[model samples]
Each structure stands twice: as C-alpha cells, then as structure tokens.
Target chain A: MTDPSRLALVPFVSVADMMRLVHHIGLETVLTELAAEIEADFRRWESFDKTPRVASHSDVGVIELMPTSDGSFYGFKYVNGHPKNMKEGLQTVTAFGLLADVSTGYPVLLSEMTILTALRTAATSAMAAKHLAPKNATTLAIIGNGAQSEFQALAFKAVNGITEVRLYDIDRSATEKCARNLAGKGLTVVPCRSAEEAIEGAQIITTCTADKQYATILSDNMVGRGVHINAIGGDCPGKTELARAILDRSDIFVEYPPQTRVEGEIQQLDADHPVKELWQVITGAVPGRADADAITLFDGVGFAIEDFSALRYVHGRLRDSGHFLELDMIADPDEPRDLFGMLMRAG
Target chain B: MTDPSRLALVPFVSVADMMRLVHHIGLETVLTELAAEIEADFRRWESFDKTPRVASHSDVGVIELMPTSDGSFYGFKYVNGHPKNMKEGLQTVTAFGLLADVSTGYPVLLSEMTILTALRTAATSAMAAKHLAPKNATTLAIIGNGAQSEFQALAFKAVNGITEVRLYDIDRSATEKCARNLAGKGLTVVPCRSAEEAIEGAQIITTCTADKQYATILSDNMVGRGVHINAIGGDCPGKTELARAILDRSDIFVEYPPQTRVEGEIQQLDADHPVKELWQVITGAVPGRADADAITLFDGVGFAIEDFSALRYVHGRLRDSGHFLELDMIADPDEPRDLFGMLMRAG
Candidate 1:
C-alpha cells in the first residue's frame, strides 16, 4: 500500500494531547485566550452561517451535531448528553470536533472536544460575566459542583477577576471533590453546605447541575437584585436550572435565541419573551447590565460558534505545541478519478 | 499522567486501514455484504430515526452531516462535495463517519468514510437495482465515468450479476482510468465515446456524473423500455443528470422522499410528484418492477440509513479484522465528576 499524501492527513488531538496542550499553554491562559477568541467571533456573529444544533433524542439521552461556518472555515462538534451516565461511571457529556477549510471541504483538524467543551463552556460563561456581572465582583457561588464546577470557578477567576468560589452540590462528595481540585489554584475555594449558604455573599451565581428534568436549582426569592446568574446546566429541552419566576426577575441574555428558546433556561418563559443576544452586548449594540440593582442573567446553552472558536484556537496552537497526531483520514488518490485504482494498488 | 481507561478509547479506522480491511474481506464480498446489510436495514426502515442531511453550502462546494439512529446505535457521516476540486486534482467528495452507542452517547468507532462512502454508495445503488432491475439483467452502461464508475461496475457485477459494463465520460481519460481499474474484475469493460453508444445493449443505465450544475446526461430518447435507471449524480439542488421527460415516463423509486424531492433528479418534477420509497419495496409493502417492459428508476440521493448500515457492518467486522487504531477521544476519568482533577493530574 502506498503512503497517503500530506493533503490526506488531518491533525488529531486526543484527550491526552488536549490535556498536554492545555497544560503547555497553562489553563488560565487557555481560558483567557479562549474567552478572547469567543468574544471576537461573537463581535462579527452576523458573518457566520448559524443554525440551531441538530439533535437526535432517544429514551436515554440525546446526540447532537453542532455545525457552523464563518465563510473561510467550517466547524462542527459531535456531542452526546446522557445524565444517567454519571451513575455508570461515565461522563454525562462527551464530544469531539473538527475544523475544515470551506473551499475544499477538507478537514484540517480533529480534536477530542470533551475537555475542550468544558473549557469553552466555562470560557463563554466568564466572557459573558465580564460584560454582565456587577463591577468588582470578586466572589462566585457555584451551585452543583460536579465535573464542570472547578473549570467554571477557574475560568471566572481568570476571565472575570473572581477571587473566591463558593461550591455547593446535593451530593456532598461532589462539593468536596470540586473544593479539593480547586485547592491552591490562586483562589479561595469554599465548600458550602446549602445552596443559600453558597450564595451568601457572592455577586455571581452559577447553576450547573446535571439533572435532566425541570428541577429548579435556584428560586426567585433566593436570587438577590444585584447578581449575575450564569445558568449552564439547563441546556436541553426538559432540563432547566432556574425557576420561571427567577427568569422573570432577571434580564436574560442568550447565545442564539432560536436555540436557547428551545434548550436553555429561557424555555421556561413565553416564546416571545424579550431577551438580549450576548453577541449584541459584546458588539456594544445592546446593553448588558442595565443598573447596579438589576438582576442579570447569562443563559448559556453552549452554541456551535463557541466550539468553532475553540477548535480554531486549538488548530492555531498545534504549530507551537506539537501535541497532535496526523491521521490518514482523507483518501487522496494520485488521480482524483482513480479511487478504485488506488484500492487496487493497495491490494 | 495515568493512562486513559478502556472506555475512553475509540477505535478509528483510517483510510489505509479501511482499504486493507476491504482487501482483506475482498472488494466483491465487501460490496455484497454491504448490499445485504443495507437491504436488511431498509426492510426495517421504520424503526430508525431519519433526517435529511444538514448541509452547509459555500460558493464553491458544500459540507454536509448525515445522521441517523436505530435506538441502539447512532451514526453520522461528514461529507463534502466540490466539483471544482477536481480541477485542482482533488476528489469531488471526501468523508468520515462515526458510530456511537445510543445508550451511553459515546462514540464506538470512527472510520474514514471517503472510500467507504464510495463503496456504500455503489453497494446501495446495486442493492436498489437488485429489486428494481429486470430479471436476468447483465449489462450496465455508466455515464460520466469518474471516481465512482469502477465501483458501480464492480458492485453491479457482485450484487446484481452484471457481466458487462459500458463506460462513457466527457473526459475520455476518466473513462480510460475506470476501464483500466475494472480490468480483470470478472466483467467485460467497454469504453464508449458517447452516452448513447454506452447504453446501446445495456439492461441498466447508471448516471454518475460530477457536474455541479443542471445538465442532462441522459434524455428521454436515450432511455428505453425494461431498463432500470440508477440515477446517482443529481444529488444536490440545481444538479441533475436525467431529463424531466424521462422521469415522467418511468416508475420512480426513492430512498427518502422528503430528501429526494429537493436533491434528486426528481427535483425537476412537481412537489407532489408520486414516488415510491425503496424501503417500502424492500419490505414488500410496495411492488417493484411491475412489468418487463416498464422502465424503473431509482432516484437515489444517498440517505443516512445506508451509511448507518455501512458503519454498523464495518464495526461488526472489527473484532477479527483488527484493522483499527485506538484513539483516546473521550475523557473518561475514574470518577465521572472529577474531569478537572483528571486534567490537573495530567499536569
């Protein structure tokens, strides 16, 4: 069999490679850079070909393909969400993504997106908080300290200048795990016993529970007037973290309304309820935090553009990090019309 | 860093591995088995989740994601079609696919689909012909002999008992390449100067061209009684191979009506144009090939179910074949909620 040409090879970053890349660039820097990339993409969001994620739902879970293109490049992520996976000692969400040149439709980069998704999700939240959170917000209350909690805490610390994180989860061990993971990470990690206790003196409250139903992680009265709410867990149709009353009290901002209305916490409200697009806020076309006394909500459902940004960012880092393997993924026969001949030669 | 667990590793079949596996299984046997698998899936078609491919179109080409699931397993293929790429010495289409567990929402296999797509497409065309073609059919005339022509010829020989293939292409060199590839493949290869001469004594006419715009490769007068038409190239909007008059004269069958109406040769007809689903015919709900003299047309805009069948078949052959690489594409921590801890330990 003949060796594949260079054009047929696609750079692939496995989980270990992604971890190495993250460490090589430093987590804080990665988070901050990812935030910057995402923000930059959001600034010119109209140039993108955006669509609501295409999701296939089964009885147990859902698998989705999130695809978006920005004229020059195309990107998509294959992600599955199964909340019951936790009990099976598996991640509730696992993903992989690809970036390709739009002109030729050839994949240039393929990366394990489980770690990248977590990073991008946190980075997006922190980026939004930078625009919506009250000034000098130093403390963050993270409700549901699970797999995503520490990343959220660290991202907020890096991007939004949060110096302390108060963690709480229904499962006590999860809180302890998050706290332990965040130890000596340049932030004060406080393990709180109750949801109210976690939000005691924090200006930003992040709800990231892993329930698959409409369970209210936070209620109307529990939320104060001057706090920024980062709702991340309420990502699918029947799953939401905040109560409808809490949504009514906050000025909600979302990634993409067509998608958020179907999958985010905004699903709890009326279909026509007014909400701001986060990109508009970033581009200075829409106001973020209206007043110091107003409640601000960033309902992030994790859009395709953020994943696109993350993959593009990783593709750029491949040159310096050298933490990728090239897989002979595309079949580039010497003669474009002789694919069968190529196979015959291999035989 | 600790080695990734078994759950994190996904088996990836590169183009070389796929080629070797195909040669190991024998190309003819692979085509026959793939046809049988696709036919079996077609028989139980209603049990699967079906959606038209999600396409992202650019000025030069298009990238598409085709996804489907059958309760137990979910599969998706990422493919691109760029007719202009041929001018730059690139294949018109390249693809990769993934199969995942529906229950856990985790990828089980990742295989290079560029070659597999060519194989599956040919297998599907031949499988459809097996049902719709006249009994004792022996000759296939393939128009626009490009990368797909040789595979079509071989698949017909393996699955439908075709003994001769007449090939024609606007570019005579493409026809020469195809004729050379199909040499000694247990079939008579005839290279023709015109589409008319190619179908002279052939029982089946396979139109597989690469032009992106609407251009009639076969007209009403070129088609005759009792011949089955396997329309393969008019797969996108504004790109068709057969004349509308020919479609009106034949008994048209389609894989998925909602999709074929928008992307097949039948797109030239009315929205309410009557067409039979190939699965219905395979399951015996609808009859195929009404009479010996009646022309039967299979307007196949390749569907997701066929790719699912192909991926499922490849996945089943992995155990003994062992023609795959284990990729650490999933982040499987010992504790499901300790992903951050896993990354920190990697550091």
Candidate 2:
C-alpha cells in the first residue's frame, strides 16, 4: 500500500475490478446507468470546456488524447486503435483515463478504459437511440460482431428495450463468439450471413467493424428508411464505412461537430453540412427525429465528455462496492515547495 | 497499493520524496544525469513523433497538454500556471505526468511533477548554459525569487560551478524566503534592489517572473555582451518578458521550434527569424555559442521530452528506494477483451 501520510489518493480500478463491477451491477444495468450519467452531463453541457480530441496518426494506427474540463473537475483519456493488434493477440483498442479535481489539479481516479470504452460506446449508442429511435423499436441489427458487439447488444437491451438482435461479421468465428459469450442474457440472437441480411427488419443498426481503411459496409440501398444507425467504425480521417448517399438522406448527430467534420462519418460530406450535436439532442435544444420516416445516424467517434462520464461513473461505483486500490499518482507534502526535502524524508 | 497481478505499475514520487532523492543522490548528480538523458533522447530525434502542445487559456491561468512518442514509449504532462495561485496559498504551477508503452498503451509511471518540473527546468537551463555560457563563468543573476528560485540557484551552482548568485524579485518577502532557503548552500548570495543591480557583472542571467501578460523584465541596453540569458518565464501566448532588441542581438536556442514559435520568447519575433533547436546543438548538428563575447539566449518553455527524461530519472532512482507506490493504472487480464470478467474475478 502507498504511504497513508500522503495528502491525496488516486483510486485505481483495474480491468478485473472493472469487470467485477459490471458483473455485479449486470451489463444491462451498467449501460443504463452510464447512459443516465451521460445524459445528465449533457444536460449541463454549457458547464464544460469542450473540444474535439487531439489525434496523432501513424502508418500502423492512431493514438489520441481527449481532454475536457468543467470548472470543478477535469478529465482526459489516452486511447489508441490498431486494427492489426488482433493478429498480434491484442485488442483493437486500449484506453486509460484520469479524473482530476480542478481545485488543486489533483487526480481522484485512474482507470483502465479498454472495457469501459466498450461499455461507454454502447451506452452512448443507446443514449442516442433514446432520442432518434422510434418508441416501438425492439430489434437491433449488430453488424461486424466483435469485442464490442456483446456490450452494444446488452446496452440496447437495457436502454431501448431491444429484445431481438441479428449479428453479422466478415469473420464467422467472431459472430459465433459474440453469440456464445452473450448466451442466457434473455435476448434472441440470430446469426446472419451478411450485413444486408442482418439489417433486414431491425429498427436500430450498429456498425462496429475493425477496419483501418474505408470499406463500404453499408450502402444506401441496403439501409432502410427510419432506421437509427450507430456508425462506430468510420471514426478516422479517410476511413468511412457508409456511402455518401446514406449520409445525405439521414439526419446526422455527432458528439462534437468540429471533430466529426474531420474524423467522423461527416468527414465524407462537405464542410457546410448541417448536423446536430448529441448534447443538443439530449438537452432538447435540437430535434432528433422529426418523423417516423426520418433516418437518423449517430456518427460515434467517441468524445472526451463520454470518457469523463465513464471515469466519474467508475469512480462512484467502486466507492459504492468498497473495491478500490490507492495509487500514488500525486505527492503529499507538509510543505508544498520543499519537494527536494520530501525526497530526503522518504527513507 | 494496487493489484499485484497487474503487469503495469504506476510509480509516483511526491515533492518531499523528490527532495529526499536529490539530497541522497546529490543535486549535482541529478542535474548531470538529467542533462545526459535529455541529450540522449534528442540524439535520435527522428524517432520521436512530436507536436506543439495543446493549451487551454482561462481568465486567470493556462492549462496545457504536452505529448510525445518515440514508437516504443509515449509520454505526456498535464501542467498549469497561475501566477495568482500564491496569493491563494498555492504554488504558482502544479503538474503531473505519465510514461507509457506505445505497443500496449499501458502507463509504466505516474509522477507528481510540481517539484520535478522545477528540477527539470533548472537542469535543462543548466544544460543549455553549459553549451552557451563562456568558459570560467562563475556567477548567475536570478531575477525572480519565487518558489522556483531556490531550485534554480541550487541547480546552477551544482551544474555550472557557480560560486555567487544575485537575487531579485518584486516581492521582498519572496526574496527573503529564497535567501533563507539558500543560506547554507556554500555560495555568496547578494539580495539586489533592482534588475539593473542583479544583471551587473553577471555571466548568466536567468529570468523567471510569474506574470501572465507581456511584461518586459529585461531591456536590450541593460543586458551586456557575452551574457547567457536563460529566458524561463515567457511561455504562453501574449506572455513574454524579453525585449525585441535583446532577441535581435542574441544567438537563440529553443526546446521545440514549432512550439517555441508560438509560446516562447520567439513568439514576439517574426516567424522567419532564425533559431537553433537545443537538440541540434546537443547532437552536434548546429553551433550553440560561436564566440565567448557573443550574447546567447535559451528560450526555455518546458518540453515533453524533458518531462520524459525526468520521469525516467525518478523511476530509476525510486526503484530500490521503495519511496514509490504501485497503482492500478493498467488493466492486465488473462483475457484482454474480458475487462468485465476481470473485475468479476477480482471480487
């Protein structure tokens, strides 16, 4: 254990501990609660210092830093995506983040965000569906079944009452694994041969494929009218999955517009294309879907605000469960400026 | 303490512990070692993916994110500067940073840098001075005597063999505090009444005023020939201290050109003005001080590379000392994708 004499503590939640929280809370409940927290944060969106994430791209993959702050709290996430990682026995994405107190610039929590990212993405998709999807929506078409597919399925089941799910992926084993892992979850999971077959009659369509380049996973002809699409794969520059015709016909919503214009599905469109921010839709400042026939899309590139919400949620939940580890991320000193002295006294 | 099974550990050094390290290892050794590390990292500069820092300016202060990667390792620092913090009984600057593995994106070290920052800044300045300052230089004029002043005084004495220091600050109490802090340091201390008194006959002039606006602390006429000026205070946009004439007359060196152009003393000059990056000089690619009588300037806006160096130093020093605490910052799992399952197993 760290020195108890320290002035502050940074609670760390490892992957194992995070999964325990998920299992105890249940996947559906965690997603629903996360959505509620996200909605609450969005309702007071004006309080945050918002910006699009900063990204550094390399030939192999992209690494990004997403930071945001309210007057009282600060949060940032370090995340990377390398589609080739799976071939190397690694996940496609890995993330970690910090929640800090603005008053003293001290971190309160540090957490592994790999699993949290999946959960937040699912929760965010479900949150977007609360506004865009039809009230009678009960079925979801999950294209590109992978690590995130099960979480998305469970999130939809919790937030949108989605009871039926059709899964499809280029790799049949991935879809089968997703189905097997999600067994006895009280949902009907149907394996489909292709993306077109998966979206046959579903009201909510989520595409979370792990492709580093542009591949048209969904063309305009295959996507039906009024279907709410959560496009999670097309999240980097020059990497999009949907055809321009589909974006042109849909009502697009984004986390942050300036970022979406550069890195989201909206990158496929012109600069002047109008889109509503999800915060605006969540806060009722803008319309989501005006009619039953309105095709709505949530171009999910992931935002710092969602990570902020996720970090805060995990910090709170760990406290409730009394399962946390103290980290020596910050120094505690009797005299703040005597940093040199602190070291001398360590022994 | 964190979970022992987690592969990555977060080792933190507090201000007091850092001081203890300095006292134990000796200040001279720390500066010498830090300089070597900084120089080593810069030698293979092409390996690093570097970017100008992203800064968020508030009414009272500025917070910034500085990130860099060398394919194998990644590092970033979260720092803030508010001159008014002292009035509120706080340090003028507070910082923390992380070093991570690029391949796995796991943090290996998390450190409190408020004290380390002061050390690294001084080490960097002394490193630059060793190249730029004339041979047989033995005196330094420090123009700011705030919390960082004592560190600067000690670092210069340790790294450069300075035997005398002239201290000056706008606040007399701060100057007195610095004098008291450095009383038994084996150097002659002169408390000066004015900036003119401080610079007289000094081989090196270090300015570290804590103003966030453009305030001239040195004039061209006041600075004599052959003086190596360490410009440490001017780091944010619209916040510069060097007169235009001094810059026009001196041979300037910087940490990162892209960043120094925007936030360093060079921010006041035209974009086309010539300047040498410190790395180029350190690596023998460019000339630093051409002659003994030529005025030299080191525009010191703290860089991520330096923090990376400092993190490496602290991590090495604390290993056997056991002054650090392990944190659950990385999520290591038997099944990487089963983040939720890891937590469940922990329970």
Candidate 3:
C-alpha cells in the first residue's frame, strides 16, 4: 500500500500533549492568549454562524454537539455532562473538538477538549469580567472549588489583574484541594468555610458548581451592590446556580440569548426578560456596567463560538509547539474517483 | 505523570487499518455482515433516537454531523461532501465516526467511515433491494461510476446475488477504472457508454452520480416495469438524480420521511407524497412490491441509524481484528474533581 497523502492526516492533540503545551507556553499565557482570541471573536460575533447546541439527554447525563463557522473555517465540540460520573471516578465533563477548512470540508485538527474547555471557560469568564466587573477590581470569589476553580483563579489573575481568589465548596476537601493546587500561582488563595465568607470582600463572584439541579449557591441577600456575578454552572435546562431574586436585582448580560434563555441562570426568569448581549457590549453597541452601584450578571452557558476561538488558537500553536499526532483519518485516493482502485491495489 | 487510565483510551481505526480489516475479513463477507446488521437495525428502528443531520452548508460544499442512539450506545458520524474536490485530486466525500457508551458518555470506538460508509450504503441499498427488487434479480446497472459504484455493485452481489453489473459514467475513464478494479471479483462487470445502455436487461438500477445539482440521470421513459430503482446520489438538497416524472410513476420507499422529502428525489414531489417507510416494510407493517409488474423506488438518503449500526458493527469486530490504535483522547484525572491537579502533576 502507498503512504497516505498529507490530506489524509489530521493533527490530533492528546491530553498529555495538551498539558505539555500548556506547561510549555505557561498556563497563564495560554489563558491570556485564549482570552484575547475569544475577545477578538466576540467583537465581530456577527460574522459567525451561531445555533444552540444539539443535545441528547438521558437519565444519567447529557451529551451535546456544539458547532459554529466563521465562513472560512468550521469547528465543533463533542462534550458530555454526567454529574454522576464523579462518583465512579470519572470526570463530570469530557470533551474533544475538531476544526475543518470550509473550502474543502476536510478536518485539519482534532484535540482533547476536556482541559481546553476548562481553560476556555475560565478565559471567557475573565474576559466578560474585564468588561462587566467594576474597574480595578482585584478579588474574585469562586463559589464551587472543583476541577474548574484553579483555572478560573489563574485566568482572572492573568486576564483581569485579580490578586486574590476566595474558594468555597460544600466539601471542605474540595476547597483544600483547590487551594493546594493554586499554592504558587502568584495569587493569594483563601479556603473559606462558607459561600458567605468567600464573598465577603470579593468584587467578582463566579459560580461553577457541578450540581444538575436548581440549587442557589448565591441568593439575593448574600450579594452586595456594585458586584459582577459570573454564573457559568447553569449550562442546561433545569440546572441553575443563582436564585431568582438575585437575577431580578442584577442587570444580566449573556452569550447568545436564544441559548442562555434556556440554559443559563436567566432560564428561571420570564422568556421576554430584557438582557444585553455580551458581544454587543464588547462591540461598543451597548453599555456594560450602568453605574458604580449597579449589579451586573454574566449568564454564561458555554457557546460554540468560544470553542471555535479556542480551537483556532490551538491550531495556530501547532506549528511551533509540535504537540500533536497526525492520524490517518481521511481516505485520499490518488485518483479522486478511484477509491475502490486504491483499496484493490492495497490488497 | 501517571499513565492515563483505561477510561481515557479510545480505539481508533485509521484508513489503512480499515482497508486491512476489509481484506482480512474478505470484502464479500463484510458486506454480507453489514447487510445483516443494517437489516436488524431497520427492523427495530422505532427503538432508536433519530434526527436529521446537522449540516453547515457553504457555497462549495457541506459538512454534517449525524448522531443517533439506541438507549445503550450513542454514535455519530462526521462527514463532508465537496463535489469540487475531485477536480483538485481529492475524494468528493470523506467521513469518520465515533461510538460512545451511553451510560458514561465516554467514547469507545472511533473509525474512518469513508470506506465503511461506502460499505454500509451499499449494504443498505442491497438490503432495501431484497424487499423491493424482483425475485432472483441478478443484474445491476450502476449509473455513476464513482467512488461508491463498485461498493454498490459488490454489496448487491454479496447480499442480493447480483451476478453482473453494468457500469456507466459521463466520464468514460471512471467506468474503465471501476471495471478494472472489479476484474477478479466474482461478478461479471460490463462497461457501457450511456445510462440507457447500462440499464438494459438489468433488474436493479443503482444511481450514485457525484453531481451537486439536480440532473436527470434516469427519465421516466427509460425505467421499465418490475425493476427496483436504488437512488442513492440524490442525497442533499437540490441534488436529485432521477427526473421528477420517474418519481411520479413509482411507489417510493424512504428511510425517513422528513429528511427524504427534503434531500432525496422526493424533494421534487409534494410534501405529503405517498411513500412507505422502509423500516415499516422491513417489520412487515407495510407491503413491499404489490405485484411482479409494480415499480418500486427506494429513495435512500442515508440516515443516522444506519451509521450507528455500521459503527457498532465495526466496534464488535475490534475484539478479534486488532486493527485499531489506542488514542489518549479523554482526560482521566485520578480524582474526578481535581483536573487542575492532574495537569499540575503532568508538569
């Protein structure tokens, strides 16, 4: 058999390779770069082909396919959310993504997105905080200290100049683990005994719990004036982390209203609730923070465009990083119409 | 860093491995097995979750994700169709697929579906012909001698006892190439100059042209009584292969009504066209071929359940075939909640 052609091979980044690339470029740098890419894409969000994720729900969890295109390139992520997986020693969320050329419809890159989703989620949160949070804010309060807590802390520190992160989880060991992981990450990590203690002096609050129910990690009374709340954990229908009272008191900003209205914290509110699109705020079409005393909430259900931005960022790094394997995923017959001839010759 | 757990490893079958596996199992046996599997799935089609493919269309081509599940396992195929690619020495279609365990939402198998799609499509066509075609049908006329022609011919031979295949393509070289590739195959191959000559004395007429636009590959006058028409090329919107008159004269059977009404030859007909569901025919809910003189047309725009069945078939072969590579595609942290700690440990 002849060697497969260049078009037959797609660069694939494994989990170890992704970790190596992150450590090689420095996680803070990757997060900052991802934020820049996401911000740039968000600034021109109209150029994208956007749709709500296609989801398949089951008794245990949900599997979703999020796809988007920018006319020149197409990308999609296959992600699963199984909260019950953790008890069986499996990550609650696991994902992988692919990027393809729009002209030829051939995949160019495939990568493990479990780690990248963490980084992109954090980067997206921090990027939103840069615009919605109070100017010169330094402290961030993380309501759930699980797999995503440390990445969120580092992303805020790297992208928003955050100097401290207060972590709190129902399980004390989770908070301790988060603090231990962020020991030398150039920020002060505080393991708080309760969510109230964690949000005492924090100007930015991010909630990313793994519960699959409508549990209020933040209530109306606990939140103060002039604070930005990044609600990311309420990413599916029937799952939210913020109380209805808290949402009513805050000015809400969201990524893709059609999706956020069903999956974000805003799902608890009326369908006709007025909320600003984050892209509009980024593009200067809408104001982000109304006043120094006004509360702002970013209801973030992860969108496909963010994943496209992250995959594009990773694709650009492949040339210099050499952190991918070329898999013979596509069949390239020498004579385009002679695929059977190629197979017969191989035999 | 510790080695990735077994949960992180996904079995990936590449193009070469797929070719090798086909040869190892013998093409005829594989096609017969695939036909049986597709037949079994079609019998229980109501048990599967079905949806039309999610497609991203461009001026030049389309890329699609087809997903389905049978409650126990979930599967999806990522496929592309760029008719212009053949002019640039690339296959007009390429595909890959993944099968995941529904309980955990973890991928178990990823395989190159370009060859497998060809096989499954042919198997599907032959399986459909089994119920619709005249008894003892021995000759097949393939109208478009492209990448899928030979597979269709062989599958008909293996599953429907087709002893001769008449091949015709607008480009005569494509027919010559197909004939040369099927030289030593059990069936006799004949090259014809036009579609009219190809269908003469043939019992099963298979149309699989590569045109992205609607073309009258077969007209009403050319198709005779008692012959089963397997139209597989009219797979996308605005890409019908047969003339509208032919569709009006035949009793059409379709995989899925909503999708076929938009993508198959039935697109040129009414929205409420009288067509029998192929699964209903397979399950004996509907009668197939009312009489020997009745004209039966199978409007086959491939469905997700067929791909799901194909992926499941390939996955079952993996236990003894050993023609796959283990890919570290999933991130498996020792503590499910400590993904950041796993990354830090990797560093």
Model 1 global lDDT (CA atoms, 0 to 1): 0.95
In terms of lDDT, the poorest run of 10 residues in model 2 chain A is A336-345
Tens-place lDDT per residue, model 1, A216-267, is 8998889998999999999999999988998888999999999999999999
Q: Residue B245 of candidate 3: its Cα lDDT?
A: 88
Residue B69 in model 3: lDDT? 88
Residue lDDT tens for model 3, A1-347: 98999989999999999999999899999999999999999999999999899888888998899999998999999999999999999989999999999999999999999999999999999999999999999999999998899999999999999999999999899999999999988999888999999998999999999999999899889999999999999999989999899999999999999999989999999999999999999999999999988899999999999999999999999988998999999999999988888788787
lDDT of each: 0.95, 0.81, 0.94
TM-scores of chain B alone in all candidate structures, in the order given = 0.99, 0.95, 0.99
TM-score of chain B of 2: 0.95
RMSD to true structure for each model, in Å = 0.8, 3.3, 0.9
1 or 2, greater by TM-score:
1
Stretches of candidate 2 off by over 4 Å are A1-6, A20-27, A272-274, A283-285, A315-321, A344-347, B1-25, B183-186, B219-221, B243-245, B270-274, B283-286, B313-323, B343-347
lDDT of each residue in B105-217, candidate 1, tens digit only: 99999999999999999999999999999999999999988888888998999999999999999999988988888888789999999999999999999999999999999
TM-score of chain A of each: 0.99, 0.97, 0.99
Residue-level lDDT of model 3, residues B1-347, one tens digit each, is: 88899999999999999999999899999999999999999999988888889989999999999999898999999999999999998889999999998899999999999999999999999999999999999999999999999999999998999999999999999999999988888989999988999999999999999899989999889999999999999999989999898888899999999889989999999898799999999999999999888889999999999999999999999978899999999999989999999999999
Higher-DockQ candidate of 1 and 3: 1
Q: Would you give me the overall lDDT of model 2?
A: 0.81
Best by DockQ: 1
Rank by lDDT, highest first: 1, 3, 2
Distance (Å) between predicted and true CA of A192, model 3? 1.0
How displaced is residue B258 in candidate 3, in Å?
1.6
How far residue A235's Cα lies from its native spot in candidate 3, in Å, is 0.5
Query: How well is each residue in B221-318 modelled by candidate 2, as lDDT tens digits?
Result: 99888899999999888889889999999999998899999999999999989999888887888998999889999999988888888887787778
